[model samples]
Target: MSKLDPKLAERLRSNADGLFCAVAQQRGTGEVLMVAWMDGEALYRTLTTRKATYYSRSRQSYWVKGETSGNTQYVHEVRLDCDGDTVLLIVDQKGVACHTGTRTCFDTDILLSDSVE
Candidate 1:
């Protein structure tokens, strides 16, 4: 993300609502761990650190997940959607990925879809 190409910069700026959604999933388990938004800085930080980081719209700042909770998401890969407005992260997850101590943020999907993982 070091100085995005002109086309990519335009794309990142165009439809972003000033923020792009980032979804993290466990690669082997196929468990969707969490979904958060990333600004340019957050996106760059994640790529550089190989850790999941996001922008908190409500708090209006950067948030590196697991900084305190120890539920760190070690990013394996990051994919930008065709639209370049969303991102998917394949991660090595540890412990819970949710604030509620659940394995995934979308744990409710277990009851609804029967294939949450």
Candidate 2:
């Protein structure tokens, strides 16, 4: 049912829905672009295609980043956190990373700041 490697699959710790939190970051700049969820199949597709694919909780389906939005994320590397519950994607983003047409999902949110020091 899952195309992910057995060894790799065993290392992952997914939620009840069998999903892992995936964070996308711009390669060189180290800018976090967006956060999404990935199921085993979505991870498999991303690893195989070098494209950022995520499972949409709302849609209850898989979607490739930029499939329709023209904003794409080309994965360069993937890292699993120590807990194995989060995945970090180093990518080359071609366009906006947020659905709102922003460069990143965090751009509009500023709950805290550097001046807090």
lDDT of 1 by residue, 24-109 (tens): 99989898888999877787888889999898888998888899899898989989889878899999988899998888887655
- Candidate 2 clashes: the total is 0
State which candidate has the highest lDDT: 2
Q: After superposition, how far is residue 36 of candidate 2 from its true place, in Å?
A: 0.3
Please, what are the lDDT tens digits per residue for candidate 2 over residues 1-117?
Answer: 889999999999999998999999999999999999998889999999999999999999999999998789999999999999999999999988988988999999798788854
Clashing pairs in 1: none
lDDT of each: 0.83, 0.94
| Candidate 2 wrongly placed segments (more than 4 Å) | none
Model 2: C-alpha RMSD to truth? 1.4
| C-alpha lDDT (0 to 100) for residue 29 of candidate 2 | 98
